[model samples]
Target: MIVPLRKCLVPEFILGDGATNLANRYIKFFNPKKVLVVTDRGLKKTKLVSNVEKQLKADNISYCIYDNISPNPRDYEVMEGADVYRKEDCNVILAIGGGSPTDAAKGIGIVSTNHHHIKSFEGVDKILAPMPPLVCIPTTAGTSADISQFAIILDTELKTKLAIISKTVVPDTSLIDAETTLTMDKELTAATGIDALVHAIEAYVSTASSVITDMNALEAIKLVKQYLPLTIKSPLNLEYRNKMMLASLLAGIAFSNASLGLVHAMAHALGGLKDAPHGMCNAILLDHVIDFNFESATNKYVDIGNAFGINLDSSNPASSKALLIEALQEFKHICGIQPGLKQIGLKKADFRELAQKAYNDSCIVTNPKDAEIADIEKILEYAW
Candidate 1:
């Protein structure tokens, strides 16, 4: 059979200055009876929700707002959201916020429509039923969860995250407006923006990398190199925010197709075990993973440096790898990311056990180079 190098799921992405106002325009497209607005308490308290609510109210859209989502959302929250959606007779799910709330919405949509436990379907393609017409509006510049078919759901009972992969999880519509990200604090904006960079970089060299995914990843990297710092320094600048948002969107698309690697696999393990912030965990592990993968991907490291404006043309492979490591460290420093997992309250004593789980993560299989448990332990030590 003749097939493309990479298979991707497309979403109805609505981008513009005032894309939020176009909700009513596409409402008939989904033919949803009731709308479920999934978000977190912070956003509902902010003007972002007020702005979107105003538009929905103007259109007389019947909606219910569930804003109790947590940072690392637990399994129970998915069931709770499903309850709310069904109780309100919601046929459409509108998710607004960062990865946590958005991912929670996908979980809710699946369980609500499928009439089953979210945990019951944990692996790939376990979602056999179609979800409601879900729409996602990302308020952050990172966590490309907005347009992707993947949702990283946490099983708080087990204290680990699950990558819920299914084509049905891709939103029916995405309302991306850069202006919403302007209010993010400097730290979160930088961290999430860097997270997006990691996504792009990992996808660029993934074993599954295809021509289409490579284009998306490379473009994302170029844009991230140009815009992440600007957004960090000038969060209110519409141009900078717009650029970062676009980069994140591209990164999400790239990784969604090519898939992520050990950086995310290992980071998610750390976050689950220590309850660390997803972005912070990723930031802490970024350099270590890059350094760990350096020997196997010297050419890719050079490309990463070149993408970030490092003059590596005249540099040797070892020098280029070192330069890439230094660049990643510098990127984290500029973003003011935390020093290490130790600083984030991860007990170093737990590293051995955590390393095992991280190594077993499904994301590890598709990394450009596979590492054994010893390698993962060393990476943890480096991140330490």
Candidate 2:
């Protein structure tokens, strides 16, 4: 008997109270004379960036800032960021924000050193050279690009999303400070939290899943189920925020190893096409995709239902799957996630194109059920 080979990759991450305050230590370890700090314009208004800046300044670390990143980061944005990184002669990259800025930072690292357009690196393991030393501080408890081996970049010309997956693109270090998430609005909190849930669910049910990934995915699901609502209601509750952050980190590790499934594949297309929030797109499509995938991976769905605190009987797989979907709907509603793609401005006319893009996404390859173009189209229509 031959045992299948499985490898896991993860970035060095620090998680706990005041983790962001340790930026100076990590930057010092990089031994770079200058750092390129990549983030969005919106983050500059918050103390999250300033807090890290103050720490960097205290340590006498020189840095350059590129804040032109969009909510749905574009191909051009990555190029522009790379230009700044080169012109500033920055040796290290520091990303401080949600998924967009972190992913853009990864793109910048790829293009600045690889001498290729960011789009060229799209798909799994296309990146040849290792990225510049990167330090990430995530202000949101979702996406988990800081630790994951994936970067999502939008192609404005094609109105689609491209995924760049390479272990080399993973950040050298990441700070998980739950305090940073306190600044997010209720909507952002809900969206990002649900995005973490999607990651765990997709990873758990993915055909690539292993025992190691499954453990992390299940724990992440349980943590999100227990803590997401508490964080949403209180907003400043540090305990809940920390749990959500941990869940996000675990989910990141799970998907980074096991890969994602159809929910991410569909959400990536919808988000790239509309320049929409990726997390919210996942939130809208998660239950629908779960229904589509239930028959193929009923045991995983039952496990998910158990994590959600539902008393799902695995013996009755059909009823268990329904319970799982219903629980997800109720959980999403409680977290204030608006239902349906129509609420996010997706039109029926665009479904066909979105389905084609989703079908082409690499994430779909790992889905437990093989999804065809027509099946993807129906899912999009149903989501709409």
Candidate 3:
């Protein structure tokens, strides 16, 4: 038997209670003239950003803040952040929020170093030059943009999300602290938790899945299944928050290496077209994509069901698939995600365009089953 070659990419990371406080030490290692602190306006209302700034100031590290980022980070926002980086004479980027801020920070680094519009580096390895040093402090327990080799940026004109995959975009360091997640409300928690679950499921069933990625993906799924509901119930429980953060980290490593599948591909399209929440989009489309790809990867789906504590009989693949899909829908509702595509403003007429964009997304390449535009449209219809 022959084995295929595979590679895993992850940034250096420190995890625990005080992980964010180490920002000063890591930024000082770069000896940057100034740091570009990228974050969204939502985080600005919290003490998370100011707390990190206090640490930077204690180390005499100068920094400037850019909070012009939105939920689905736009192309122009990336360019604007790059301009801020240049104008502020910053050599390092320290992102201190969720996926939007971290992804925007990556985009800013790309344009600032490569000297190209953010839209040019849309697909895989389009980045020719290495980005500036980046340090991420992720406030959300989902997206995992802190360590992944992927960044999602929305095109304002096209109203579509661009999937940027490259080792160059990976951060230099990630400060993964569950403390920051304490500020998240129940809705944000449910959405992001489901996003991490989708990442694990897709990675496990991806065409590129390897033994190493499978291990990470399965463990992540188990963690999310067991702890996500507990966190929603005990919103202020640090222990629950820590578990979800670890789940996100493991899922990030798995997907970053094995890549994602149709769920992510279609979710990206839906998010860009509707400006809807990315995680919510993934949550709505997850079970439908699983049903679409289940026959192609029955064993993998059974494993995922086992991770979810479902004793699926692989011999009865059809029954097992239906049982797993039913459980997934229940889990989504249990976690408080109740909206479908229509509730989020997607129309029946838009399915064709959304399906076309999803088909063209880089993530579609690794789906366990090859999907046509019509197949994606069917998935969208089912999700609706």
State which candidate has the highest TM-score: 3
Q: Candidate 3: deviation at residue 231, Å?
A: 0.6
Of 1 and 3, the candidate ahead on lDDT is 3
TM-score of 2: 0.97
Candidate 2 local lDDT, 154-258, one digit each (tens):
999999999888998889999888988988889999999999999999999988888889999999999999999999999988888889999999999999999
* TM-score-better candidate, 2 vs 3: 3
TM-score of each: 0.96, 0.97, 0.98
- The lDDT values for all models are 0.84, 0.91, 0.93
The alpha-carbon deviation from the true structure for residue 339 of candidate 3, after best TM-score superposition, in angstroms, is 4.6
lDDT for residue 191 in candidate 1, whole number 0-100: 79
Candidate 2: residue pairs that collide: none
Per-model root-mean-square deviation over C-alphas:
2.0, 1.4, 1.0
Candidate 3 runs further than 4 Å off: none
C-alpha displacement of 31 in model 3, angstroms? 1.1
Worst-scoring 10-residue span by lDDT in model 3: 1-10
Report the poorest 10 consecutive residues by lDDT, candidate 1.
1-10
